[model samples]
Target: MNARIEADAAFTDWMQHVQAGMEGTLDAYLPAVTEIPARLHQAMRYTALDGGKRVRPLLVYAAGELFEAPEELLGRAAAAVEMIHVYSLVHDDMPCMDDDALRRGKPTVHVRYDEPTALLVGDALQAQAFAVLSGNVEEQYAARQLKMLHLLAQAAGSTGMCGGQAIDLASVGMTLSLAELEQMHRLKTGALLRAAILLGACSGKHLTVVEQAALEAYSCPISLAFQVVDDILDATADSATLGKTAGKDAADNKPTYVSILGLSESQALAEKLRNDAHKALEQFGNKARRLHELADLIVQRKA
Candidate 1:
């Protein structure tokens, strides 16, 4: 197969594996939480199972595969990453935040259930992510697992996603510098992406300090590229194709790359970032092909 086709196939297989792993986690864990009300459970399951691109999970598996990590172990890590992502989305769509009524081509948790239930579901998903990590049977390295948990907590907590969200809310309708926009996205999206690759590498115990550094460098550009593409799609794509409301950022008066840099310049920036991301993986030879392709796919994706 051609490199791009092979990469797409690998990504498809990984997505199926991730979806199965996530369903398994829900089956195993949801029943154990007997105290959870049925409504809350429904809300949680509704949003959690809602279809997404599952990019973060794919990154986890790809990073692990690059290092020859075991499938079972990588699946566990992928599940954990996805749990965190779903939790963030549920909370982000609440009325107090983005107030989004739709996600993944369906009503958001708040729209389906209520704000309170949505909040609770988000909380439960976040807690369940740590629980899943703790329950990983294939984790032979205690120190590595602990490190992975720590990385996730930091990324999902005040220093990362939460912080970015706070800044984003504060910046509504206000013009921000390119530096400010980059700062916002680095914490909002980059931290988890960086952690996804790092945790996968850590799981395999195959990452040299230099390799870690290279991946970190690669993540920065790709993360920004991801956000830029999102901005572009928000302006151009509809909710049905995007799986979320289109033109929302502009409607909400949020500052975006498109607003700051213009559409053409934002696209050029994404291309430059994609090139830089590919260059960061050059040292790894063919083993890094998927990673490079992933960068291209992120910028080129319609949604």
Candidate 2:
């Protein structure tokens, strides 16, 4: 095969491996549908196992591979991060929140099941994430693992994602300066994405201050870029292509980069962020090839 075709094949294979591994790992961690509170557990499964791209878990495995972290350690950590992500989606789609009725090309948990069941699904997934992380992480890195647990808590709690969501809820139909918007996304979206990389990298070995700095340079921009592209997609794509309610931001009057910056400027900014991600990975040499690919994937993805 030609080099370009060979590279494409490799990329496809890498994505398959990571996605399949995460699916299996998540399956092992999530409660069986037959368990008590069966409805809640089943809803959790529906929300989590749905067809959304496993971006966070792929980041986990990719970054962990850089440090040669044990696959077992990466699997547990990835599961935790993904569960937290799914929980956020469930709550985001609630009547009290985004009020969307579809996600990943299917009816959202709240729409398919009852609102109360969807609420319980989010709560259960969050708790299950911690259970999987704390219960299975190897004791050899007890101190490190504890720090990882704390990191996830901070990322998901009042200081991070929740804080950002509160800001988002308050800012509806209200204009925010670009700085304010960036800060909100940094906390709301970037925090968890950053934690995914850190957790993955930290799983195997401690990174030097310089390496840590580099990873941030890559993750921070890409995190924001992820949101920017999301805004762009919501504006440009249809619900069928996006597998969720497209144009919801405009419909709901939510503030977004595309709203304030205009489509051309937002697209420019996303490209800048993608370039910044590439520059940041220079220190990692070829080992960060997957990271580079992932950064590109975040912006270039259709859904």
Candidate 3:
């Protein structure tokens, strides 16, 4: 196989592994409160097991690979990141939040279950993410795990995802500057992405200051690129192709890269960001092939 195809296959295999690990971890962690409610658990599984691109978890694993971390340890970290991501998505689709009816080519958690169930499921997933991290890791890594936990909490909490959602809500139908739009995405999407990469690196014995800076620089543009591509897909792709409702952003009159920069400009920006991400890995040379391929794949992803 060609290099690109080989990389794509590797990514696909890694994603499948991450999903299985996430499901297993969730099964073990979710039984903590099995006696209370069936619907809540159903809702939790509905959103959590709903297949996704699993990009965040993949990033975690890829970054860990750069440092030669063990696959089992990386799987645990990947599951933790994915749990946090699913929790954010569940809440994001709530009636009071994005009010999204579709997710992953199916009815969202709120639509499949109910708003209250969705709410609790999101909360449970958030708590369970920490539980997975704390419960599965060795005591020797406790301090590092705590740091990862803190990064996730900060990224998912009020100052990050929630804050970005609030801004998005407030900006609906309102014109925003390019800088403003970028800032919103930085907090909303980029923070968690950066945290994922950092968490993976943190699993190593140490990260040099330069490596830390490089990861941050790389994550910023890639996160925005991810969002930009999302907006483009929402505009041009169908629900079947995207596995979710299409054209919803335009329908909701939401501010997006397409709205602010136009489709062509958004595409150009995504390309530029992809290049920027690759550049950030220059120091790692051929050892960073997976990361480089991941950057290319993000820009080229149809879903």
Query: Which structure among the candidates has the greatest TM-score?
Result: 2
The numbered model that scores best in lDDT is 2
Candidate 3 minimal-lDDT segment of 10 residues? 25-34
1 versus 2: better lDDT goes to? 2
| Superposition TM-score, candidate 2 onto the true structure | 0.97
Writing each residue's lDDT as its tens digit, candidate 3 over 72-131 gives 556667777788888888888888877888888889888888888888888888888777
Compose the digit string of candidate 1's lDDT tens values, residues 192-211: 88878877877786578899
lDDT of each: 0.83, 0.90, 0.81
RMSD of each: 2.2, 1.2, 2.0
lDDT of 2: 0.90
Tell me the spans in candidate 3 whose CA falls farther than 4 Å from its real position: 1-8, 19-21, 32-35
TM-score for each candidate, following the candidate numbering: 0.92, 0.97, 0.92
Q: Candidate 3 clashing pairs?
A: 105-243
lDDT of 2 by residue, 57-83 (tens): 989988998888877778888999999
Q: Least accurate stretch of 10 residues (summed lDDT) in model 1?
A: 25-34
Which candidate model has the greater lDDT, 2 or 3? 2
